[model samples]
Target: MGDRVYLNVLASRFRAQLSYRTSFVLDFVAQMLGQGGELVAILVLFGRTEELGGFAAHEVLIMYGIAGVAFGIADLVIGQLDDLPRLIRTGQLDVMLLRPLSPLAQIATGDIQLRRVGRVATGLAVLVTVLSTSDIAWSFPKLLLAFTAPLVGAVIFGSVWVVACSVCFWIVDGRELANTVTYGSNMFTSYPITVYPSWLRRLLAFVIPGAFVAYYPALALLDRPDPLGAPAFLGWCAPLAALAAAGVAGLVWRFAIRHYQGTGS
Candidate 1:
């Protein structure tokens, strides 16, 4: 019953977005253009140099593709959670708690934005373009990693979103700080982590685990060694990283919800 309710709410939200055809089209195009600009920037950088942090242009594109697709999916699904502060300030969350459905599910499915699919499509196009032209030594495991990497990356990013957004329950105005983790991490992971200084690299890799989102998986897919001297098998540990992040997000979310004190409006 809960699953059915969630799906119905999601479907209705999706349909509502499509109802505004002109606005939807414009937003969709804007999303694609915004994402395309990032891709173009990567191309321009590579034009000036053959390699970035020891990664060739096409190799970095693999990272961009995977990170782009993953972040797009995460944004489309739960980006609405960023609005929690507004909802809290308005006391609308009181209404949500009165409902039988899970509050997290309600918030996530409440305002589904179909236009974000444009970003996902853009990323997928890059992924396909590079996958076709790159000289990857494809095998069964490699093929599986290529197929699963984006999904795993999505989980990692989504978990980061949830854990970060949970801060609204405390600060009520921490979305900017949260974005430094959610959106900031997306930009950080889109390129080779090798380019970053050692301290920043370690922070992204160990502290935030953004490197597991796409960087490590790209290495696994490309059959390249980690430039940082980590084992090759660490590339395949993305699932573990996703699971760990999800666990932390779950705990943080539950704790925040328990401590939530309405605005008393």
Candidate 2:
């Protein structure tokens, strides 16, 4: 029953996005351009220098593809609704909450954006290109892990989005900071984390676990050494780390809702 309701909501969103054909096409083009520019910048940087922090040009490209696909899919689906706070402020959340199904699920399925499909295709193209050029081994287990790596990355990025949105309940102005986390982290994660300073690397690794989400896992997939000597367990723990982050965000979201002091709309 719950799954059926979610499907209905998703169908409605798909139809609505289809209603704005021109806008959706333009949005898709803009996103592809922006993403393409990001990759071009990385390529130009690598052209000047063979490698950054022990990762070769193509290796770094793979990392970019990993982060891009992961984040693009996430934001296109569950993460883009970071606007929940504004909805709650204007009493918009009341309608969602009053629905028979879960409000959170409703919000998640409310917008089935097809523009993101273009980004996903571009991301996968880059991913396949890099993989084809790289010298990574292709054992069944390694192949399985490599394919699933993006899933963990997507969850991690989405969790960050959720946490950022939840902060809006306490401080409406904090949404900008949340954007910094979502967009900044997305950009930062696309490269080798080792390029960053020591303190920054440690912060992202332990504090936010962003380092593990892509960097560490990519290192493992590429059969490279752990520059920071991150624990062997860290690579396997990527999905768990994402789950932990989402769990914390969910707890905070619940608290915010319980104590929701509306903007009195």
Candidate 3:
């Protein structure tokens, strides 16, 4: 029943989005231009430099592709988290809590950002291009990793988005600041992790687990080593890292929900 409700909500969102055809197309184009500009910048950078840190251009492109696909899928599913502040500020969250369905599920499936499809398509294009052109030898594990990696990444990113929105339970109006976590982390993950300073790297790895969502997994997939001296096995730990982050975020989200004081609307 819960699953059926979620699907119905998702379908309604799709139909509603379709109602705004011009706006939808403009949104799609705007997102494409934004993402395309980033890709162009990365390519231009590689064209000038032999490599960024120790990673070659194509390798970094794979990293970009990984981050893009992961974040794109996550943004598509959970983009409502970014608007959580508005919901809280407008007191619409009361309506959500009153529903028989789960509040988190309601928020996630309540609205779909179809513009994110542009970004996902761009990432898949990058992935296909890199996979075809790059000469990395593939193994069975690697092949399996290719399929499952993005889904794991989406989960990890979605976990981060949830935690960011959970803060809205307390600071309803000012929660837009949480975009630093979502967009900031997404920007950071789009490049080779080795290029960043050691302290920054450790912060991203240990504090936010951003490394797991992209860098560590990409390293393992590409069979690359960390110059700042992380273990080779850290790459294989991506799934565990995601689970740890998601677990913590889930706990925080639940606690926040329990502590929620309505906007008194």
Maximum-lDDT candidate: 1
**For model 3, what is the error of residue 96's alpha carbon versus the real structure, in angstroms, after optimal superposition?**
1.3
Q: Estimate each model's TM-score.
A: 0.97, 0.92, 0.94
- For model 3, the run of ten residues with the poorest summed lDDT: 168-177
Best-to-worst ranking by TM-score: 1, 3, 2
Candidate 2, 76-115: lDDT as tens digits: 8776467776676678787776678766777777756778
Clashes of 2: 0
In candidate 2, list every pair of residues with a backbone clash.
Answer: none
Model 1: residues with Cα > 4 Å off, grouped in runs = none
Which candidate has the top score in TM-score?
Answer: 1
Q: Which regions of candidate 2 deviate over 4 angstroms?
A: 19-23
Rank by lDDT, highest first. 1, 3, 2
Name the lDDT of candidate 1.
Answer: 0.91
What local distance difference test score does each model get? 0.91, 0.79, 0.82
The lDDT, on a scale of 0 to 1, for candidate 3 is: 0.82
